[model samples]
Target chain A: MPRRTCGNRAMIWALRLGLMAGVVLLWEWWAPGGLLPTPGQVWHAGIGLAAEGRLWRAVGDSLSIYVAGMASAALVGIPLGLAMGSFRLFGRVVDVFVFALAATPRVAFIPLIIVLLGLGFQAKTFIVFLGAVMPVVLNTYAGVLAADRDLIEMARSTGAGRGRIWRHVVLPGALPFLATGLRLGATIGLINTVVAELYTAVRGLGGLLAIYGNTFRMAEYFVIVAMLATIGVIVTEAMRAVEAHLSRWREER
Target chain B: MTHIRIEGLGHAFGAVTALDGLDLTVRRGEFLVLLGPSGCGKTTLLRMIAGLLEPKAGRVLVDGHRPEPGHDTAMVFQNYRLIPWKTARQNVEFARPGTDVSGYLEMVGLSRFADAFPGALSGGMRQRVALARALAAEAPILLMDEPFASLDAQTRELMQGELRRLIATRPSTVVFVTHGVDEALALADRIVLMSPRPGRIAEEVRPGPGMREYLWQRLREMVLNDPGSDFYGREG
Candidate 1:
């Protein structure tokens, strides 16, 4: 049975790699004048950017802004979410405002943010923060609310203090939900990083995209887009790994 | 002496009364079982004693003071509410932090599976972890609401015997609630039967040595055909 599973896994990998290669080959043959650049040319552009050290700088700038926004969101969102989830009175008071903020189109705030913070890292970070914080807050709140009451009661029965109950019961129970929120926030933060840079700044990957597009550097543009996509994939995969590690106890393995 | 005293205890959810005007006294280190049919307030009574539910009209006193949840009392629930994120050892250790959990896990025959999480354990095994956790806390009053009700017959019987032995070794004021007559007979020094909705005590019996057969028949009669029982009241 193990041998068969191993074989099946290998076959699945083979198919996935073959499909990706096939797409790149098809794109290469389609047209040289087309909007999309070929995978090989995109790869060549990535190497050229790397040689000039522009690729590293752009990547660094984007990541720093993204991380700053995401970290601040986590700092604000997690505790607020826990408070709102665990206490009915607090939840009632805060829910309306949180929902209103979450419902507004975050992209629409870019102009306002630029006006307030100017075309600096602060504006980009604020835009990303607005885009990302809502999901983390909402999901964390829902997770805390949805935690099994029986478990909470059990913890209470064990002479656990309020803090202990939150640590041992509420936090662990909400981990999967928190992971989902973080993954979503990371993705949205990426998008906002690009959007904020597009609207205001001339640094980061988004800025690079603008420069390449205006200069008709299609290969370079595609490379930057590819890099953004790769970052998104890597961040999501990392979040998933954390989720699995934390939730291993809950899953029937 | 009395470890827990319920005086004119009453509880209602909105318009539906679950328990009303009930009073009971549990002696220190005695295995007092609350035996009744469904909706007879057995659970409500247990919850009140555990300080998890507030009585609408009455009060529960633990050691002559109002009950304090997680301090004077520990409870094992029917659902075996173990923390899914913690292993068997951690669940037990949670009850009494900074204490070695192996002793409790060993007592429950779960020492070997101490590292296993609730999700990985069988229903009976999870219940054992819950039991071990409750035991480790060393609460003066132990309240259980049909803690083994979800187990299969063999496992239920096994758990019943295990619980009896565990309590015997470290006797506490135990108030166990169950619908299973055999279970009560097997575990209780005294049994209190309750009436249906708006539940009140109907009968109390002490099971003496070699009286299992007779007591079983008598309890069956009380459960199924009593004139003033909830059985007739619901039917009427």
Candidate 2:
């Protein structure tokens, strides 16, 4: 059975690789001229950016901003969500405002944010934070509200005080939802990082995209887009790994 | 000596009364079963005794003071409410911290699966963990609400035997609730039959010859007369 599963895994990998190769070959053949750059040209452009050390610098800059924003979002959002969920009066009072803000487009605030914080790291990070925090707060709140009543009752029956019950039963019960929130927050944060770079200081890969697009350097533009896509996949995969690790007990079910 | 006293115990959910003007006394180291049809408020009585619920009109006292959970009682719920994230050992330890739980786990015969999560265990095994947890607390009272009601017939019988053996070795004031006549006969030293809804004590019997038939007949009469009784649905 183990050998059969291994063979199945190998087959799946082969199919995925074949599909990717086919897509690249098709793109190379179909879009050789005009605005579109061939795969080979994009590859060469990526190598050029790497040789100049611009690729790593842009990646580092973007990642640092993304990390800072997401970290702040989690720090503020989780506790706030917990507080809202735990305290009924507080939740009822604040939820209306929270939902209203979440419903509004975060991009609309970018202009005001740039005006206030200026086109700098702080402004860019704040934009990412705005994009990331709502999902974290909303998901965490829902998670706490949906926590198993029977489990909470059991804890109470064991004479667990309110704080102890929250720590042991409520927190652990909400972990799967918390992990989901973090994953969503990370994705939104990355998107906002690019938006921030473009709208604010025009730095990182977003800056490269603007520069290359304005000059009609299609190969370099494709390189920047590919870099962004790669970063997105890596970040999402990392979040999934963290989620799996956090809920190992739920894995059997 | 009396271990627990319930005086004029009454409760209602909105207009639907569960228990009303009920009074009972439980002797120390006694195995008493509350047997009735579904919706009979047996669980309500058990919860009040566990200190998980407060009686709206009356009071439940354990040894002259109001019952307080953990210090006064440990409970085994029908759902086997073990924390899914904690291992069997950790779940048992949760009942009373700062004490070795190996003995309790062994008592439930789950020493081999101490590291296993409740999710990974069978229904019977999960209940064993719950039993171990309740036992580890070493509380004066053990309140159980149909702890084996969800198990298959064979497993339920096995658990009944296990429970009897365990309680025999370590006696406590036990108040168990169940609708199964066989279950009550197997476990209880004295069984208290409850009336359907607005529950009150109907009869009390000690298990012996012809008692099974007598209880079944009484239950059938209650089910026939009480339109709200879910007994027929449950038995069928």
Predicted structure with the largest lDDT when compared to the true one = 2
CA lDDT of every candidate: 0.85, 0.90
Worst 10 residues of 1 chain A by lDDT: A1-10
How well does candidate 1 score on lDDT at residue A64?
97
TM-score of each: 0.90, 0.96
> How well is each residue in B1-236 modelled by candidate 1, as lDDT tens digits?
88888899888889888888888898999999887767778888888888777789989998889887768998999998888888899989998999998999999999899998889899999999999999888888888888887888888888888988888887688999887767777788898877776688988888777655655555566667645444312110
Q: Write the per-residue lDDT of candidate 2 for residues B1-236, one digit (tens) a residue.
A: 99999999999999999999999999999999999999999999999999999899899999999998988999999999999889999999888877899999999999999999888899999999999999988988999988988998889989999998999898799999999988888888999999988999999899999998899999999989998787842331
For residue B130, model 1's alpha carbon misses the true position, in angstroms, by 0.9
- Candidate 2 lDDT tens digits, A162-222: 8888888888888888889989999999899999998999899888888888999999998
In angstroms, give how far residue A193 of model 1 lies from its true place: 0.8
The RMSD (Cα, Å) of candidate 1 is 3.8
Candidates, DockQ = 0.64, 0.68
| Chain A TM per candidate, in order of listing | 0.91, 0.93
